[model samples]
Target: MSDKITFTLHELVSELDAQADELLKARHGITGSQFIALATLADVEPTDITDLARCLGVTKAAVSKRVPSLVKAGWVTTTHPPGQGRRVLLELTDSARDLVERAGRDLDEQFAALVDHPDASGIDLSALNDHLNTLTAIFRQKGPRA
Candidate 1:
């Protein structure tokens, strides 16, 4: 490859995301973004749209847009707490929890296979993951460039 490290990294990220979306859609009938949202909800305590958006690094509008579809699909349910007029609490349904568990296992297996492939021999995946985590932290700290 040429010395365009950032370009290569961008391409890799895009391709990986595309592939993941495709796999998730085919296997679970959910988009990658939806799956991510569901996973986040599973991890965190019950929260409203704004807090969920913050956890997902997205806008409130983005999370709001997805909520209806998730509810309609039976993956999520929203409820307004007593006296909490406009604030809606979001939670994953039992089916969504099941889907998340299955998808997590499938993705984990796929990741293991990818890293264990012959072509990936000699790669220190743990160190690579640590470096990627560090890079992600730096990017989050710096925010996005103009």
Candidate 2:
């Protein structure tokens, strides 16, 4: 067997995301974007779109695209406070929390099952996960290259 690793960084990311998408497909009809938005909504306090977008490391327009679907799906609600005027805030319903919990469980199982990789043996997945999480945080802070 060759000692060199064949997978590129992009391929690794793509495969990881593909696995997540497959898990989501088996249960939820919502897309990954929607899942992310839902999680953000569940975690963050009421704030304007700009702040939410910044916290999400995305543009307001990108967040906006998901709002309608979220609202229509009954996972979120938007409202303008008395003094807040046109500044709208988002809130996640109980349904969103339930979905997040279920998805979180699936993700936990999916990650735990990584140690059983077909081509990998005697791998320290916990250590790999910590490194991956750290790298992801660093890259997420940096954002995409223009």
Global lDDT scores for all candidate models? 0.89, 0.79
| Per-model TM values vs. the true structure | 0.83, 0.76
TM-score of candidate 2 to 2 decimals: 0.76
Alpha-carbon deviation at 58 in model 1, angstroms:
2.4
Clashes of each: 0, 0
Summing lDDT over every window of 10 consecutive residues in candidate 2, give the lowest-scoring window. Answer: 1-10
Q: Can you write out model 2's per-residue Cα lDDT over 1-146, one digit (the tens) per residue?
A: 33444456667667767888777877876666677777776678576677789878899998888788788989988898898767888888888889988897787788778768876777787788798899889989998999
Which pairs of residues collide in model 2?
none
Candidate closest to the true structure, highest lDDT: 1
Candidate 1 residues lying further than 4 Å off, grouped into runs, are 142-146
Candidate 1 structure quality by residue, lDDT tens digits, 1-146: 44798988988778777888988999989898888999999988489999999999999999999899999999998999999889999999999999999998887678777989898998887788899999989989998899
For model 1, give the 10-residue run with minimal summed lDDT.
104-113
- Top TM-score model: 1
